[model samples]
Target chain A: METVVQQLLNAAQLGAVYALIALGYSMVYGVIRLINFAHGDIFMVGGFAGLLLALRFTWMPLWALMPLAMLLTALLGVAIERVAYRRLRQAQRMSLVITALGVGIFLENLVRLGVGPETRQIPSRMPTTPVAWLQDALGVSVTWDKLLIIFVSLALMALLWAVVHRTLLGTAMRAVADDKDVVPLMGVNLNRVIAVTFAIGSALAAAGGVFFGQAYSLDPYMGIDLGWKAFIAAVIGGIGSIEGAVLGSFLLAGVEVLTVAYLSSNLKNGIAFGLLILLLLIWPSGLLGRPASKKV
Target chain B: MSLLRLEQVSVAYGAIRALHGVDLEVREGEIVSLLGANGAGKSTILRAVSRMLPLQGGDILLGGRSVRATPAHELVALGVAHVPEGRGIFPSLTVQENLALATWTRRERRHVEEATRRVFRLFPRLAERRTQAGGTLSGGEQQMLAVGRALMTGCRLLLLDEPSMGLSPLLVREVFRAFQEINAEGTTLLLVEQNAHMALKIAHRGCVLENGRIVLEGPAAELAGHPRVREAYLGEAGASSPPCPGTPGSSR
Candidate 1:
């Protein structure tokens, strides 16, 4: 029972990181209908941004450093949209996809060249002591860092929910998702809404990158693997739904962690992907995604 | 001076020209209807005036200043609201959210609330469904929501494209009655419709667009009685039909 509880905690930590990254894919897709294939590289860039900020400002607390890194990474995400994606908005979908792939490759090479092909970790600032209550009563070992990661991620997600559901800017974002052409008719600047979407999505991914670095290690190419996993999570939970992404991430992480723990570690990817395929067969629009409605 | 003017405006969709040097005007507090068959370029004129499509030549002026280079979004602050074809409401958003979105340019909380209350008053059905998702509404209710949303922009001029399309005759009457009320309350209207019989009844002035040019323009009553318009648009059989030029069935 204790071992099961430990595994669940491990799954929760990994799921939190996945949820943070998956939200970007869902949001950007919701507004523009573009897959934004370069999103994974943005995660990698965010990890580096966090690492650089931590190294440069050693005295800055993790709370302060994380936001600064997010801001820096958000700017990069906006710049990428402006330089690489905006012009091809009216062009063919294939052209946009190809451009996104090119941008991803460009970011990967840029990071690899700048930082060299070396794996690095963010210096751990989170409290590493196990929870006394859990250790004494439940006889399970769960570190403060892991708990902090899960709680902080949930808090961020809650903040995002409020922004999307309660605020005007968020309403405009939802409006853009529903019908891009009509949003401008309502006096909302479509470009400005899109830019804000990119900024928020990228910022969340940066939080994920920072957490991942603290928990595990960061490499320039880490985004390629983890990014795909998050993308899959977003796809599994309706691609445009914020809640769906979080749910999908946790579900995927739970399956993978359990498969590795009780079954062969090599079967983890196969099971995770198999579950996605099986779920899709039943709910083609995704678990929470509304089926595509035809425009009259 | 006219509140809105198109000084020989032309618009092209790529190689094909949709509006060919169309000249028009709308005085303040008037309902001007543009009537034509499909592909006759009625909607294109609205698109050009709203800045949805760039003009290939000439210019559009709103209240004397040239709006030829103005973007679509800035028109809202200038008190121009466009209710595009098919009732452009955000489906996933609730009725209240749909109305609130149009108040994007207005920062005053009091003004937004006042405008929203006025919209609900104008269409009581929408008030009942305030929390319901916009897509779940009936066609009539959705049209009301669309018009209500336009009102929320605090617009001086409302541009409506095919406001009567797809609704039953009774619902069409209800929607048009709302338009008349909206007009009576001091909002100028530029309405485009294939439902000429209904559009002419509410309009003070009317223009008949054929193949991108204003072939005929006059008082709405006069155009309603005109033999050519009677035959082509109103479905009245003319005594001497001359191929019914530019009607969808006769167009080459």
Candidate 2:
């Protein structure tokens, strides 16, 4: 029973990180309808940004360091949209997609050259001590860092949900997602809404990067693998839905963690990909995605 | 001064020019109907005025200031609201949310609520379905929601494209009556319509557009009785008279 509980904690921690990254994928896709192949690279950039900030400001607290890194990464995201994506908006879908891939490649190379190909960890800021209550009650070992990561991520998700569902800016974002051309008719600036979307998406991904860097190690190419996993999570949950992305992340993490625990670790990717294919066959629009209802 | 004036305005869709040197004016507190066949540049004129389309020549003036350089989104704050063809309401949004979105320029909470209450007062059918998704509404209700959404912008000038399209005759009369009320409350209207008979009846002045140019312009009554308009637009075949010269093919 303790073992089961510990594995669940592990799954939750990993899922939190995935959800952070998956949300960016979902939001950018929601507003622009672009798959944004460069998103994983942006996640990589975020991790690196956190690492650099941690190294420079050794006295900074986790709360302060994380937000600063997020702000920096958010600016990078807006710049990417302005310089790379905005001009190609009216062009063919294929062009936008190819451009995204190119941007991803450029980010990867820039980081690899600047930071070197060696893997490095962000100096740990979260408490490593096991929670006394959990250890006493459940007879399981769960560290404060893991608990903090999970709780912080959940809080961020909640805040995001409120912004999207309750706020005026968020409503404008949904309006853009619903019918982009008609959004300006409502006196909402379409470009400003889109830029804000990118900023929020990137900021969340940066938070994920900071957590991941502290928990694991960061290499420049780490984004390629983890980003794909998060993208899959977003897709399985429904690419354009915030709730779907969170649900998909936890579900995907649970599956992966269980597969490695009960079965061969080598079969993890095979099973995860297979689950995506099977789920899509049954529900082609992902778990939470509304079926296309565009009026003619 | 005219509420809107289009002076020698021209618009092009790539290589094809949709409007060519068209000059027109809508005085304040007047309903000016732009009557045209399909592709006669009626919608194009509205698009240019709302800054949705770039002008290749000439300028559009709103209250004596040239609006040629203004972005499309800012035009709403400038008190120009356009209801495009096909009732452009966000289908997934509830009727209340749809109206709330148009008040983006209005920062005060009380003002937004006031504007919303006024819209609900204007269209009580919309008020009944305030929480219902816009897509679920009937065609006439969707039209009401679209116009109501426009009113929430506190616009002084309302530009409508085919407000009568795809509605039953009864619904058409109901919407036109609402427009009369909206105008009566001090809004100027530029109405584009293929339903020429209803448009002429509501309009104070009318202009006939053909092949991207104004072919006829006069009081609504004069255009309604003109032989060419009667034969081409009103579907009234002149008895014992030859086909009116330059009569275009029937509008779809």
RMSD list, candidates in order:
1.9, 2.2
Return the TM-scores of chain A for each candidate in numbered order.
0.98, 0.99
Interface RMSD of each: 0.5, 0.6
On a 0 to 100 scale, what is the lDDT of residue B220 in model 2?
98
Clashing residue pairs for model 1: none
Off by over 4 Å in 1: B239-252
Between which residue pairs do clashes occur in model 2? Answer: none
How does each model score on lDDT? 0.91, 0.91
lDDT of 2 by residue, B1-252 (tens): 698999999998887788889999999999999997787888889888988888999999999999999999999999999999888888878898888899999868888888888888888999999999998999999999999999999999999999999999999999999999999999999999999999999999999998889999999999999989998889887544433334343221
Question: What is candidate 1's TM-score against the reference?
Answer: 0.97
* Candidate 1 lDDT tens digits, B13-46: 7778888899999999999999987878888888
For this target, which candidate reaches the highest DockQ against the unseen true structure? Answer: 1
